[model samples]
Target chain A: MTGAPQDPADAEACPVAPTLWLRLEADGTYRVGLTTTAARRAGAIVHYRGPVAGRAYAAREPAASLESEKWVEHLALPLPGTVVEVNPLPTADPGLLNRDPEGAGWLCRVLAGPTDGRAAPPSVPTGAPE
Target chain B: MSLEPSDEARPGRLPSWRLLDLGRCAPARAQAFVEAVAVSVGEGRVPNTLVLAQPSAPYLSLGFHQSFHEELDPGFLERRRIPVLRRVEGGGTTYLDPDQWFFQLAYRDEGGGRGGPEDLKRFLRGPVAAARSLGLSAELRAPSDLVVGGRKVSGNAGGDWEGAHLVVGGFLLGADVRAMADALRLPHPALRPLLRGLVAREVTSWEEAVGVRPPWERFRQALASAIATEGRFEARTGAPTPAEEARFLEETLPRHSDPAWRELPPAPRRAGSLVRRLRIAGPHGLLVFRGSGEHLAAIVDGDRLVEAYRVGDGPTDALEELGEDGDGRAAVAELVASTPSFA
Candidate 1:
């Protein structure tokens, strides 16, 4: 549903994926952004590499790469999809993923399909925060 | 030109010495090769000495416990079109291209000889002697690096699994120095220049540096000679054995390419969350409590609250999501609390 697009001015004031950011675009595609906790758990986001456009990726295929200050990580997709477009600039500079994860740092755009119930969001029950 | 008996060199004979040539194949095959070897050695069906050559591919490898996000700029890597690969062994990061020749040596040894001169001497002898047999005059430097004329041409690392050892190394055979330096997250400011110097001082490839197209057979012979292995070396040329196949899938596959493993634990041990979904009987019977960012988000202990702490975003959601099972919640909360911005 198209609610009034959150104002850029308002978005700047709002916290970004404080717990975790999950987005379901108008086309029924879901995008999940890491909470700062997730990012921190992943170390520093040093690099963000995404799939090429027009390529179909299986669920849990590496969706992106993250190189934090301490290590290098591959971010796997939870669902299958065709890579529609990648965040162009972030591939040239990975710090954006670490610094602005939900904004300019968002890694890839996938036209995702259901995973036949094989994969669910990691088992984090609602109301229980760790 | 056939060599006379007097001109022939004596080959080193090491019982476990085995060499594998993976004729042009995908990167996954290389991974599978190592896993197969690991399984064979683990089961006592094979000796420890195994050498595997990874075919050319656009791949980057990271050490065990290294985080992808922490060490590299994913954007830069993507722009250059390099795929990141995680290997079974532990070490720092490395880059592998078609021009590069990758070699892994699997030995069966526990940590008894680890960090000892004998282990280092044994590990370096194969590659070092191989290089010399090819007439390159290479030598082993301190630690594990191999230096040829003062330049480093190879880097090595290994770990033991169930009394079986796996040591793998990479030889820069006509590798792109600028590309490798660019790809890895280096620890020292001087790494690039130092690596360039090391490459110059240590390694000589068949195509460019050696002035001769050293065929793959030459590499194999050199390796065999160094290790004193006299057995008839043949290419594996087939799929892994069933037992090997199963063990590789079980022990190496999941962690090989998984991002969760690539991104290691973020917090110090104490700061790590102790997530628990199921009931636990500590001071009281089956105490249930929800926590957030190191504080108790909510508590319900057998219909009464014995203790409670502040419920932040972390503890509140973790408790609810982890309902009944009581898994890794506490660790997550403590980790979240220690983060810089959370305070």
Candidate 2:
């Protein structure tokens, strides 16, 4: 978890969830991306339905969805916050979602409030998910 | 993105499922009802439930993340009067008929870092157990499948919808491989034969797997029992609460049947792309055609394009630029041009 802001805080898969990777920018905005393991387990990434910018999602509430040939997964941010921006590349180009999930395929930018009812979960271990 | 296993997640089971055995129904009704139950359970208005249903007739359904135009030939369905309903669960396009027995479940998402290979096996344990009871040597396959004697016996999908974890799957009592493949939109003319053959080798039905097709009643009962026991649910057979019923009749049903929902972009449209994506099932991936007033970008967005097949030209029309390869694009273009409000 290099360059992590505080900690990753998604509700669906953690107390120390590996489902999403979070990074903090200098402006207090958080960059969120799906972890590689979650992407691989989803099989082939075919479609992405991300949150509408400006919509507020409670901690763990699904902020986006990733669809594969066999399954569909609703994605949630680790901390409760409002989505400030969403990357449009993955929605148009589904390949990046699988090939560079934590890098170029980052999902959204969220701004978390101090008392958003949920705290950041611990950082994903350096070894990460297989 | 640690894909490693952890023992920290609390072991919790899904709540008891109130079994709603709608004896037989129109395909849309079955889809709508499952959605109703999911919304109710997710919203905490109704108990967690398992639905047993059979469509009275044949129909086509698209998964939530599937673009209707991408996966199917709409005019073909319209001419045949085949109804298409888009379900919330994400998967590939599916063909449903009375010969298949459908089961859907919805429960409170007791979040504990689920959705790994092991979690998929855990979720499908009941179905695997149920299939074996019917005398097929069924086993749970990794990443969402139930196979019997090496052929897939069921199609299942899982996801969070309306705040609840929903699981949907079905047992094929009989399969019409040709119809199943034909119902889909193909990117190239050459793939038709391959399509049917591919489907035949991959899927199996009860009639094909076992010596005889067990009576639907017998199989349905077995499914309910296995699911209840394995899911740790009591299996109370009943109906949705009044609120759930109201939402179904008013909200869910209408939305399922609405053309707007059926034709929605499986994925959100690219920012600034004018017209909706005109997509078709290519041999290797999704072939997408996005055309605005004058510009059209043809790209296969998913897997690499193994081979390029050009759709030379179509009849002169608003969307004819999409080209005609004797597949179905020409027909789709004509349909789109004639319709006053083409997406």
lDDT of each: 0.47, 0.64
lDDT of 2 at B133: 90
Over 4 Å off, model 2:
A1-32, A35-46, A52-63, A76-84, A92-103, A110-130, B1-15, B109-118, B266-343
lDDT of 2 by residue, B3-67 (tens): 11242232563444578888688887766577777766766666677888889998888877777
Lowest lDDT 10-residue stretch of candidate 2 chain A: A121-130
- Top candidate on DockQ is 2
Task: Give candidate 2's chain B TM-score.
Answer: 0.72
Every model's TM-score on chain B: 0.61, 0.72
TM-score of 2: 0.68
Cα lDDT tens digits, model 1, B156-266, are 655433224456675666756555555644332322343344333333444454655456677765675554432222222233456666665664565555655555432
The superposed Cα distance between candidate 1 and the true structure at residue B126, in angstroms, equals 1.8
Which residue pairs show backbone clashes in model 2? Answer: A9-A78, A10-A78, A13-B113, A128-B2, A129-B1, A129-B2, A129-B3, A130-B3, B70-B279
Candidate 1: regions farther than 4 A off: A1-130, B1-17, B109-118, B185-208, B229-240, B249-251, B266-343
Residue A105 of model 1: what lDDT?
A: 59
What TM-score quantifies how close candidate 1 is to the native fold? Answer: 0.47
DockQ of each: 0.02, 0.23
